[model samples]
Target: MMGRLTIRDRSLLRDGVKAIVSGDVEHLKQIVLTMGVHSGRIDHARLYGDIDDFLAKYAKLDLGSMDLGQIIEELVGLAREHRISVPKGISMLSRGVLTLEGVLAVVSPKINLLEILANRMSAEIRKDFDWIEEQKGRFRNLYESSQKGIRIPAQMSDLLRMALKGQAKVNLEVIGSEQPLASLDRMVNRLVKCILCAAMLLGSCLLCTTGMQPKLLGIPLVGMLGFIAALLMGIWVLWDMHKHK
Candidate 1:
């Protein structure tokens, strides 16, 4: 006979569901182990056995036959039979896995399994390549420590180490490249010149509208000709800046 789930079981189920939805396998594993210890339904030995059984079942199937939805339905039925309360957001976890599977289907058949798993993990973590690079230093340190026998899986540790090394290599290349200050200075100068030109053109327009005939060398500055010339200069400056860019 199945036992009734307690409040603790519900809480652990919620956490496990969240981890699944987020694609956080590490957290999921931890939750599973904790739940097993608490309920005596999924100890370490049973966990390994379950994994082996799952893999063995799927090993004979092709990609098309891997019906995730059917598998989830079966799991839900089993949970019900066991008198376990299914966690909320279980649908979200299913959707996330289905999305990952869809992505894998579009990729090259020859794509490495490790790469595919890494991609799925990244999707679950909601982290991008740029974010990884930004935290490269911290990750590098963690990777080094993980080499000394961290509790994380070997594949995950290797992936983290690779990301850190890749980011470091990119940073080194950027540091060795030519400085961009000269280009930045040129851009600032161009922007300043454009603003000055625009200001002059606006001032000329104001003078013309106010019927003030400002002149330079008696050429009737701030008249139609002056406004036109200033406007032309502003446009030319903007065009020049665009060309430089």
Candidate 2:
């Protein structure tokens, strides 16, 4: 069930939760600032209940907690697994709590949520280092290889350009592939051509062949006619393929 929060409070909480989810440190700082400044003047019990209801309402997915004990446990667990430490914002319990740390209790399972998040943020740095090492290994292999080979296909280049342009759907009048990224591309093109060609061939054969009755499409003597007759007989095949495509 949803909590009985006022619209203004709900808006504040929604924005607050979004800031937490996005790990917006600056916004959290403001929340902490506002809360800390009013901490002494606020009704502590009511404020605590509000927090409890908020957690229960928000934590539909994760180890969402309504209690400080659960929040601490989750954070502690993450820390042990990832070898991460809590920030100074959460270190002093006697002090007014940091807004970011309050957000952390919801995001992380007690032990190392902050640490994991920090690691994720710096992943690009790690990726760059790893990429350099991999390139060095690739360079050494390329130089050592007996035969040097390279592939530069204009058709493939066009496809790559189309993909980068965010065209997930493609339609080609005719397909002529110099290079293929995957067998599926060739397979699809081949299937298309084969279907068209087969339809043509079937119609051609019906010219010499005679006396096959036209049942469904209501045409006269089937095999006596050419392409139209064959196509009429197997129009459903083309239709089904078209539907799937």
Candidate 3:
């Protein structure tokens, strides 16, 4: 006696066939979506045009029968034509173990153009895989919900508290003082002034001892000239100091 297939058996058979037939199409759609997202501002015309062109070119060929490597290579070439950059590591990976969600996880460590592609791919994968929803719920419960009340270590907690309370102090002490340089500068200035004064005084005394015949207002002309030069030098030094200040 021939037995008729039950509704459950028919449904299982239909799902199996649908999965097989739609696998390549789903993957291609995911790749296109990822590229659009990564490109930031999607050019809808370019995107749709490319997909339509690809479909038309490969319409005669069974996409499911094509190896994943070849498919990825074609996709990479397409992305390059459109100015999209795919990671070298991702392109090099074998297709047998690669999944849209797996690729997303591998590349989504940071927020970047690549991350946008990863997220888009992940969304596409989720659309195909209903089980991901259940997994996401469990992950959120274990990580997101629980993380809110996570306890910090005592040392770290105390440090954070101190910072929040504005009680944290950073003491910075200079290793050496600049007083020595200032003292040396003052000593040098005084020594220069004393040398100039002594030179002027000695010259004036020598001129006076010589008792030159030429006199200026009853003063020895040479001695008087030396005194005038000394006064000018003092004025110059004071002017220089004031100018600098």
In candidate 3 the C-alpha lDDT for residue 136 amounts to 89
Tell me how many clashing residue pairs each candidate has.
0, 14, 0
Each model's C-alpha lDDT?
A: 0.56, 0.48, 0.58
* TM-score order of candidates, top first: 1, 3, 2
Tell me how many residue pairs clash in candidate 3.
Answer: 0
Name the better of 1 and 3 by lDDT: 3
- Candidate 1 segments exceeding 4 Å error: 1-41, 76-85, 91-127, 131-245
Given candidate 2, what's the lDDT at residue 105?
59
Lowest lDDT block of 10, candidate 3? 12-21
- List the candidate 2 regions with Cα displacement exceeding 4 Å: 1-205, 208-245
Candidate 3 to native Cα RMSD, angstroms = 24.8
lDDT of 2 by residue, 179-222 (tens): 35455775686577667757766665654444445633443334
RMSD of each: 23.0, 22.5, 24.8
- TM-score (C-alpha) between model 3 and the true structure: 0.26
User: Against the hidden reference, what TM-scores do the models get?
Assistant: 0.29, 0.18, 0.26
lDDT of 1 at 244: 77
